[model samples]
Target: METSKRLEQALKKLYTAFHNNELNPECCKQCAVGNILDNTDSWKHLSEYHGALKLNYVGKVHQSFGRKFNGYSPLELLQIEAVFLKACGYELPLHHKNKKPKNPTNKDILFSGLSETVRFLCDLDGIPNVMAYTKLFEFEENEKPKYEFSVTD
Candidate 1:
């Protein structure tokens, strides 16, 4: 199998374990990173220039994790992070060599909408909750922003 496929499988496996309540947050996060490294196309670049993969992966991981977990548990957080990394061409099991960079700011949580297309990410270290998009558009009498659809977990 291709390295990418293997990485993807590992990441999904981690997520599945988490959804099944079979793993701890720290373990899940740590294990999933292996996939990230194995899949990074930047590995060649990082190899040619020391630290390139580490810098590139850190930024990529930060961005993906920022997008996936809007408001959820640590498990959910890792799942989303894994999803983003996979999308960006990292296979899964993000590499330890990729090395996590310190986030410039603490905020990295997901928010659904500030506009129809835009979401404001909450700080990573803070609480997670869906930032309602309804507040942006004023409704006519017949048109509510679909709050009933959103109320459940």
Candidate 2:
């Protein structure tokens, strides 16, 4: 299989395992991130290994938009995506943004762009709101809890 295929497979497998409660990096010390974080050489190796494939995909998208694409590591791109999605109201996992649970509500599920698997998990867990459960602080001091959907529960 091609390198792009491998990276894509790795990404999917990693995310799926993360979602499924397998590949618990928290439990096991031999995590991909941990390995990458342990050594600059390893981090560089992972980046170059994944970078070629990431570039191919980005190149395709850039071509479509007539935009000039430059070198950015896959991890960099992922962080950028995370920031963009957070701005659009999708919460990353707890570790990404130092998340701490806050006021509980029902309408927290209304946000778009989150993966269906994550949304489904939230629903299954009775959390009903990823934003409500993962966020630590909001700028608005008088933010009110919206629980209209709680009645339907």
Candidate 3:
């Protein structure tokens, strides 16, 4: 169950921010990458536009230099933000006229964004998705599988 230090810290920060009503997909300081980076808006400078994967000059420089913020590369931070925004119903490169969820602060909406961000984080760290529930099915009362993988096969 061990993960990289950054992954563990980021997950804890994300969880705390979500439960504390601090997560805001539109705010650079409160967004997924923001919270992971200790609620700093500096990551915003990594891209020319919000939700864009293409790194800006500063971002490119950092990426080229192998810089990492909170254990995520400049490009990775952008990708994480994009995934969070997209899953939260925001149009890419968030704008004033872009489509967004009716209730951005809704728990369910935030949860969806967090879920996708977590999945991406796990992928980046080459770890299992902690949000997955297949392990729940691994429990067995005796010597048989507690829950069959497929009942119709």
lDDT on C-alpha atoms for all candidate structures: 0.31, 0.31, 0.81
Worst 10 residues of 2 by lDDT: 144-153
Residues 11-121, candidate 3, lDDT per residue (tens digit)?
A: 778777775678898888999998999999999998889889899999999999999998889999999999999999899888888899999977678778888888888
User: What ranking emerges by TM-score with the best candidate at the front?
Assistant: 3, 2, 1
TM-score for predicted model 1 compared with the true structure: 0.21
lDDT of 2 at 78: 35
Q: Of 1 and 3, which scores higher on lDDT?
A: 3
TM-score (C-alpha) between model 2 and the true structure: 0.23
On lDDT, the candidate that comes out on top is 3
Every candidate's CA RMSD: 15.9, 14.9, 9.0
Top candidate on TM-score is: 3
Worst 10 residues of 1 by lDDT: 104-113
Please provide TM-scores, in order, for all candidate models, with all chains considered together. Answer: 0.21, 0.23, 0.84
> Residue 107 of candidate 2: its Cα lDDT?
24
Show model 2 residue runs off by greater than 4 Å: 1-3, 23-99, 102-153
Q: In model 1, what is the error at residue 88, expressed in angstroms? A: 0.2
